[model samples]
Target: MSWGVRSILHGLDFVLQNIAWKPGIDSDLNVWSTRWVDGGMPEPVDFLLEEGFGFMKDFRIKDLCYNGGGRNEGMVRLIFKQESVDKILPTPLISTRSHDEVFWPFSDEVRYTVKSGYGVIFGEFFNNKGTLKDKERLNLKKKRFCKTTLWKLPGPQLWKILLWKIITGSLPIGSEFIKRNLGWDPFCTLCGKELKEVETLEHLFRDCDVSSRIWFGSVLGIRTDQNTFLELGEWIINWITYLKGQKENYYGLTHFLVTLNSIWTLRNNSIFRGESFVQKVFFKQLGSLVSLAIKNPVMKITNDGEGVFNSNDSEDLEDELNCLKDALLVLVID
Candidate 1:
């Protein structure tokens, strides 16, 4: 085959592997073989083929839905595993009668694009080669935290990218430097010279005394030392998930991101500028950043096709700032 044709075919293979089917009337998609469910690659149901149910192998997704396009819960629960059922039921059918459409699940637009396709291919390349540690790679593929939580967060794009780097171990920290043989000291500089602990992502962010103090001193009142998760990625996922549940306005998440940014900045200053971690200065700067984030919150598109701020009104903003100030007041730094 010609090189051009061969390249096209190679790209097509990657496209097909990552694409998922969005059920409309669901008449065109085979339930057992099509990538109709979310999470990962689609596979046939794991049940043994029975005498009378051989015909089910050819069943389309529409067969499991009512004539009006609602899910046929009885047949779905009976035929598919509970895991499949859980994913299938929540998937909304098209309001009008239409054919099923193939979509790129990784992008917000749900349409195939060159950028997203390349991202999927690149991610898979590293994942297959075991470049990322096992638990981190598994969490990335399974949870899809970037698409689900990080991208949806209302903040500056830089802030989101920083969070992504931290989760993915893409930051140029001491451990990463050691891995690349850059001859930089890999020990936690924030923990001082006497302690001599290697600065892994977890230790720098969560386990170090300085970072732990920052977390504890924040308005969120998080105690990093009390974190139970073994993996830093998992630990962050837990807190982000909790923040999502607890706050409707996303103030908690915004504050959390700001605090993380401050901690990182503090670490950098300590390393590069020979600065010491001062509680008063750090908290003062953190409060200003938080206030700045509130005043200029991210803009989001509303259901009515209007762009609105993700922040509260002046009065509400004042109240929130006061609350944060009051909380910070209780945290005394010697």
Candidate 2:
């Protein structure tokens, strides 16, 4: 096929064509080449005249290397090849972990997952301590939180949890949400004292003296200062590590998740609704969920909303505040 300067730089030619060529901007190659040729003139005006004239005839002196042919063609080919090669280089890849994964892309949850799962040497999944095998490790330690409750479903649950764990990483590193929020001094909604940063999830659920006085007392019957809320997975990992010899308590695991979820829900309601952040309210919610869990421990869930709370769990639903007392009164009637 016949080739020309336009075809030699086809892609660049297309781009330049679209750009609005203003007079001052140097789009005029005739003036540019003429100036370059005049400035770069050698001691041979007679040689320049002898060469066949073309678009870049003055600048292409190097291309006419053939004894019989002119140097103008050689210079044109050299410049064209150099410019084309410069444009041919591949573009650098610019992507994020979230673009391919199912997590909230910007959150700080990935660090927590890596810190918890790998400690320092973030490596293959299977090499880790738990059921996560190396083959499953997707190096998703820094991805966005795609979903939680993946285990409650099926297939590639580990990857889903890995993603969710990253989202949970956004949980304030310190226990104090108010302090973490920056700017304003975040006072406790219940008691208007400035909160400390290290008072995070486990603190709110288990360790915070205020929360401890309520839910922990009602549920585990503990009234102590030592129990803090560990990230649920971390807490489980610790328990599994400690109780390695004992029979696995899968039921206990389910119960623990339900209870924690209940407590977090209550905490949010109390903070946002101006509802009393009292221990009694938490106990009431805890009691209802516990009672339901006791009766229907293996509650199933499905994507189409087919199997959420079991039918039995729905039978005795009552106001969380009055549910325990309401059940007791029903027993009295019977």
Candidate maximizing TM-score:
1
The residue-level lDDT of candidate 2 at 43 comes to: 27
lDDT leader: 1
lDDT of 1 by residue, 253-284 (tens): 67787787667777776777777877887788
lDDT of each: 0.66, 0.35
- Estimate the TM-score of every prediction: 0.51, 0.35
Residue 93's lDDT in candidate 2: 10
lDDT of 2 by residue, 161-278 (tens): 4324423554433334455566443444433345543445555556666656653565334453532323434333333222221223333433444444444444545555645555
Q: Which ten residues in a row have the lowest lDDT in candidate 1?
A: 325-334
Candidate 2 local lDDT, residue 85: 20
The segments of candidate 2 whose C-alpha lies over 4 angstroms from its true place after superposition are: 1-167, 172-187, 190-199, 222-224, 227-233, 239-250, 294-334
